[model samples]
Target: MLPLTLRFSLLALSCMLPLAALAETPLSTERVTELETLLYQDCGSCHGMTLRGGLGPALPESRMNAYSRDGLAALILDGVKGTAMPGWDGLLTEQEARWIADHLQNDNPLDE
Candidate 1:
């Protein structure tokens, strides 16, 4: 039989596994790359290739400060009413929207 300390260690690892999995980003690496592509190629068309603004408003951190994380995610999914921004809910999942919002909010680099 395993030693008491080893058993305890195994139990601890088992308990943490589910939480670690749960905390993981819902999008897989491949999916994230694809979404980034869409975010840059399609979304950038209006928001600007550099996200500095063109047809749409600038998405830099200063301009994005007005939105909360959840609010940004909702906007990404539902879009602004009576505006050029089209809802991506038809194309992307809620998790994907939230991920994109976080990526933007944190000023993380997106593929150009």
Candidate 2:
């Protein structure tokens, strides 16, 4: 019923729709500041203010880099089972979690 070109266009749009949905909006400067504080204070409550490890394991850049960005973001949002690590889904957006993951992997204090 549809022209070949029309069908091809529809298929292309369908493929791109999922990607568009997955695209995250940019975070604001103030939101970034808040996220940084949360990462250092709230998450820091367990990972340590300096991220040197406390009740939770240390979050060195090396270790952070070991995880894929999306994987780490999922972990941040979902929390580990049978552990003290609680999910942040209630308090954070997926974009925020990814931002935190990026910071831990790239801008973390513990370079080693």
Candidate 3:
């Protein structure tokens, strides 16, 4: 069995490896700002200003925990067919979509 420190290090690396692979190019401050606004003003229209619940379902951790980050990103970029959600694939990269997926579940600060 590995020591706790070694195990923790491996676990952290495992978790990060996928994201590191997914997002090769870091989001610039301008792009990040644009996405932030879309997330709030656009997505918020349905997901709720506080991401609680509205025309769309609530996006709290409890709800988001049901899906993996990759799955969530796909859903965001590809959109849910037969639903109100429209695909953003033409407008956003997979990396940006993945960033949004991770952000939504993590309660990222909107002010930055």
Candidate 4:
């Protein structure tokens, strides 16, 4: 049988694992600002700087609200097939992607 101390340590670790999995690194103020810029500038390059539609369709708030937050994050990370949209997974964490998705859905500038 394991020693009492070892058993206690294992129990503590098991309890903490779930909490760790649930915890995402919160975005800093600077990171949020950077993401906003990326959304308008980088994504805007195709979607339009104002998201009024350029090479891509306009990202009206009504349309943005149609997608689930997680679904939108996945789309941002994975990009659409055969489309100009490129996956940003290489440059962003899942948390960051979620933030961008939430921003687009909740705080989008275009109020169509």
Candidate 5:
């Protein structure tokens, strides 16, 4: 039988493997659009039609996209400190936030 320490180590390593795989996978554009539409209809009620900022801060010009996917995921999970941006961890998943980050990084269609 394996020693207790070795057994625990193997268990931990095995648990982390799936998390690492999940971290590497990115959301698809179609999922991104679906999330965007949800954001527009729900969060957009205050954030603006284009997320150009309204009652809430503008997201398009924000440097949010420059941050790592994990960073954006945290923001979505843990709302902006003292801001109107509510924590969306309950409403959205990390994958969805990553999708939002990807979409926000692109040039606005109106700017073209």
Candidate 6:
């Protein structure tokens, strides 16, 4: 019963709905950069500039094997008590915590 023009317009609108929803989601570039800077400044101070062994233990594959991305994010947000690590829940958002964990998970000191 719809006109051809109305049907075509509905089809186009339906096709664009998903993209419009996606566009509403904010990009996390600021959060990602904040995490990167935090790692380079705070963590790097103890873990070494390159994340190799330093005052803190090495963040090598073997050492990092026990941590999942979620686990690592949790650790960052709620630092290990009785240890040198300090919780960053107030300073970083959950997304930033996750970004740091993801970055650490992929870090390879051996890579040139």
Q: What are the Cα lDDT values of the candidates?
A: 0.83, 0.96, 0.82, 0.93, 0.72, 0.76
Pairs that collide, model 1: none
- How many clashing pairs per prediction, in order? 0, 0, 0, 0, 1, 0
TM-score of each: 0.72, 0.82, 0.71, 0.83, 0.62, 0.66
| Candidates arranged by lDDT, highest first | 2, 4, 1, 3, 6, 5
Residues 1-112, model 2: lDDT tens digits: 9999999999999999999998877999999999999999999999999999999999999999999999999999999989999999999998899999999999989999
RMSD of 4: 2.4
- lDDT of residue 111 for candidate 2: 96
Off by over 4 Å in 5: 1-20, 23-33, 107-112
Over 9-112, each residue of candidate 6 has an lDDT whose tens digit, in order, gives 99999999999975644437876676677787788898877777577766765556479888988998998899887898998777677777777777655232
- Best candidate, lDDT-wise? 2
Model 3: lDDT to the true structure: 0.82
Q: Residue 26 error for model 4, in Å?
A: 1.1
Pairing residues by index, what is the TM-score of model 6? 0.66
Cα lDDT tens digits, model 1, 2-52, are 999999999999999999977845678899999888887888899887787
**Model 6 alpha-carbon drift over 4 Å, by segment:** 1-27, 107-112
Candidate 6 Cα deviation (angstroms), residue 73: 0.5
